[model samples]
Target chain A: MIRRPANLRRFGLGLLVAMPAALVVWWFLAAPLLVPGMAPAFAWLLQLIWPQWGPAVEVNGNAWLVVTTLPLLEQPLQSAAIPLGPRRFTAAFALFWGLVLATPGDLPLRRRLRQLLAGSVLGILPLVLLMALLAFHFQLAVVINHQPALTVTPPSVHVLALPYPGWQFHLIGVGRQLGVLVLPTLGPVLMWAVLNRRFIRAMIFTGLLSRLPAAAGELDHRDGRA
Target chain B: MSRGLLIGLTVVVLAGCDAAPQDLRRALAMLHNDQGAAAFTQLQDLAATGYAPAQFRLGMLYLQGEVNAERRTLAERWLMRAAAQGDVGARYYRALLWLSRRRDADAVDAGAQALERLAADGFRPATLRLAQAYEAGDGVQPDVAQALSWYEQAAAQGERRAIERLATAYQNGELGLERDAALAQRWRRQLAREPFSLSD
Candidate 1:
């Protein structure tokens, strides 16, 4: 087993060194390239779901410009572009990478790399899904707000037969607040904690680790003979 | 001691989960899910029971989706009820609804008064709206000075739209203000640092 004091020091030092570097790489290179590419996928998904909406995606630097038809109150359907900075969500990847890298060097390089890959998938996929859902919810709000106008003629193209119920809007609103405020910050930490639970216990909860017989046995087994 | 602490924490967490907001959210979710009848059934009861948020939401729903005269009246009634209970959102929406009815001079006057009160109370959206009203002569008389003052108030509150407006006004010497490129640049820089929100 890795010495507790040395492991803690190494992890702390690793975090101090890796965090800024990871953030710099993510912000300057990876996010700019990867974030813009997500727009097309989002556009494809939106179009697939709401064919009549005819969602279009445009890349403007790090932001995705999503242009889609939105029903307006007392007016014909108008095309609106909602610019989403998905880079904000992808920034969590930097934190995830930093945490993964900051893990003590005792873990096998192959396993650490696997953990990093898993963290990336776990961290990013939900954010992507959230962005998509927020976009859809925003568009749905437009439809809901203009339900009366949409029911009338001249705007014969009905995006949805009936607008989503009010409770769904509240749910989306809550989801959005959580996604924006909580998830981006907490998600990476949670992922890191789960992935490095053993390391965490060894470093921070040594007493608890020793007190739990099963945990102690598992650690001993991992250290040598089962 | 640890076990007691854990129990205390659990109790606190449980206590923090207010059922009212959850119920309100569920009703709103029903409304968004196209289950208007069900949402209304829940909301109307809550609103009738003098739940300010429910009343405000019901008002907003009617304002947004209902075009009929009777529904409009109902929207006004619900909004008024909520506003009477000191719901700022309800008050703002009610004022906006009244302002939109420009044909009724009395309603426009009431809206202008309500907006002025809200602006004075340091409500950012209300300040911005009041400024716009003065600038465009929507519900109130076109007063460049009043517009500038309200815009400045909103800008002080870090309202992006107000900042942009002031920046443009200063740059072009609009609203009878002296053109100052330096002031315009400062506002522009502030705007750059201001975080963009979807709502904004």
Candidate 2:
């Protein structure tokens, strides 16, 4: 039991030490490899919406995915931004590294590997959902915001119909914000907590009750003269 | 092993290898593995040899900001070479680079010509660029008629921006087109029919 806690602490320390290196690898190396896979997944998600129609994703060697739609009219307008970029994937990769490093060390290497893999899979599910939401937001943003570079005569017509509903944009904005700011950090922490619940419980018990002399004295009050 | 000896021996062996294709593959592998600087070194000789793909790849690496200022100039040179060889990607990016850089009118004209060729090949983005060029006279003479025609072509190809522009122009009598609310409404109806899809 003592060794287990020490091992857990050691694992936590290992994560602290390894995090910067992990982030570097995630940004420089892992993101590029993941882009090819991520592009297709983003396309597949888009395909789910348009049925047979979907944007095509091209992977640049620098690890960016350029999403192109088939001619919306006479020509294809490339989407304003990459559907998923290094910034998006790097966060999740950092989370994976955290999970791998901080997972309970008493578990066998294979078991730990399985846990890491499972945690990564779970983390990616929500990320993919976020990507789809961002893609929709981006497509709308490009369509509405992009104007041809030439001056056309002023139109008297009022644009009564917004292409996308108002609520959807709000929702996408919130989801994207969360994806960038919260999910990357929180997702892995939650996974780590869940996977190592027993260790956590033990740590809690050891930290609060068993390790406290004051609590032990309180327990012995019945036999005291006072 | 002495460092100089090791370097000399490796250079001699690499010189004898003479397999540009394999070197290119190795460069690609290095890039995929996130060794962009190394990939650039590998690509240099092949690009100098006038290989179209290597030139294109070098241009991309330069665009990626993987290389310094000197290399950035090399990127334009390589991209121009690739474009001359009729590489579609090279043509597209070189056009974009010229536009983004907002180079002189002559450069803009060159970019427009590249775009026009691609547009002739039925590429929608090129068609859109050609329309913009005609409308703004950015590189070509401003011709509302040419612009509208290009817009119509793009809209026929299902370009969303073109559709929106055409609808607005028809409604407002912009771009020298006569105001026709009926035609505008028809395009609006088409826009409505092509709904944006997202899963909840």
Candidate 3:
């Protein structure tokens, strides 16, 4: 109403809300993936079994793979698209937030697309690291529980190697502890951002339509004056 | 004809309908009285017209190998025919045949199609077998949805094993379920009851 532009404020507010929420939900859902009694997780995982998620690493009674986490995003999206109850509400909330936060106002269409992509990448980058750490912990737990007899191999070597130490991680460099945003994977996030933007635009459509009455009233008044 | 002869004949014929009702009651009594051999003979004569219960019972006898050398495939074929004609118990036995061969998906399909007859009143032994099918992945894809469906069915029918399975599914949320602690507790509480449904 006063000074600042409505578009910029709304976009900032939207990003400030949605991106963190997506990460929060990712971490929340990752609890079952990280925890034990994971039959349901594996059962659901079976549905996600693609050769592309990465090669499977069978350890102990469990298995883990280093797939791009974008597949995870798709599962939740497909889940949310036709879900019932509170989960549906959560998806709507996330989509709405993504639109408001990621989009840039007071810019041309091309620049706006650029800003939105950049913002979403900055937001999603941390979560990818979190997911890799989670995978390492889960796989390590599996291997430790199924240690072999100490006859042929030394006990110290195998037990400790099941979980590589921090210095070892620094030296050998496995897992996503370092926040290297996979530039290629951003394509999926951008696709989802586009989808989320469309969803928010859908919700805001009714407000846009509310102006139709005012436009009609002004058109009638102008015709009378003419 | 003489009047005395006519009156006597009329009285005798008039008493037959009353005896028909009494005879059915007696048949149920004889079946319950451990006079299976005699009751079977009577039921067999009555059942020859292809009544479903007679066909089901005779099918059961053949299925169990007690009355003679068990002819399971033949028994299943007859029971399948009886079940198709709406014999409620026949679905239960026929499900067993499909299950024994690890055809759980087919068994479950059979159980659900016949639910209005078999599981309509309550879960029974046959219904519990359907639940086991979902759990063990015998003939169907291992699914929490189907497992939960069968567990709830058998639990309603008073199958203890089904009650246990439902408890596990609820407690673990193993079947794409949201964690509902209250429903899990309720199922646990219901566990300590007498066998109330047809499962007994």
Best by lDDT: 1
Q: TM-score for each prediction?
A: 0.46, 0.43, 0.33
lDDT by residue (tens digit), candidate 3, B61-148:
5654353335776677667876787554566566556655554566656544554344444435446655666677766557767767
What DockQ class does candidate 3 belong to? incorrect
* Comparing 1 and 3 on DockQ, the stronger one: 1
Predicted complex 2: DockQ? 0.02
Give model 3's share of reference contacts: 0.00
* Cα lDDT tens digits for candidate 1, A95-175: 889988988857788998998887787656666556555644554554332222112212212221224455765576666
lDDT of 2 by residue, A62-126 (tens): 45443432212211111122334544644676766765666554788888878767766676555
RMSD of each: 15.3, 17.0, 28.4
- iRMS for all predictions? 17.0, 17.1, 31.7
Model 3, A1-226: lDDT tens digits are: 1243455466668678767875576346633343233323332332234211122222232233322211111111000000001121123224433554456544566665665455434543234323433333333322222121111111111111112333543332333222223322443355455545654464366446656677788889999999
TM-score winner: 1
Per-model DockQ: 0.02, 0.02, 0.01
Q: Would candidate 1 be rated incorrect, acceptable, medium or high by CAPRI criteria?
A: incorrect
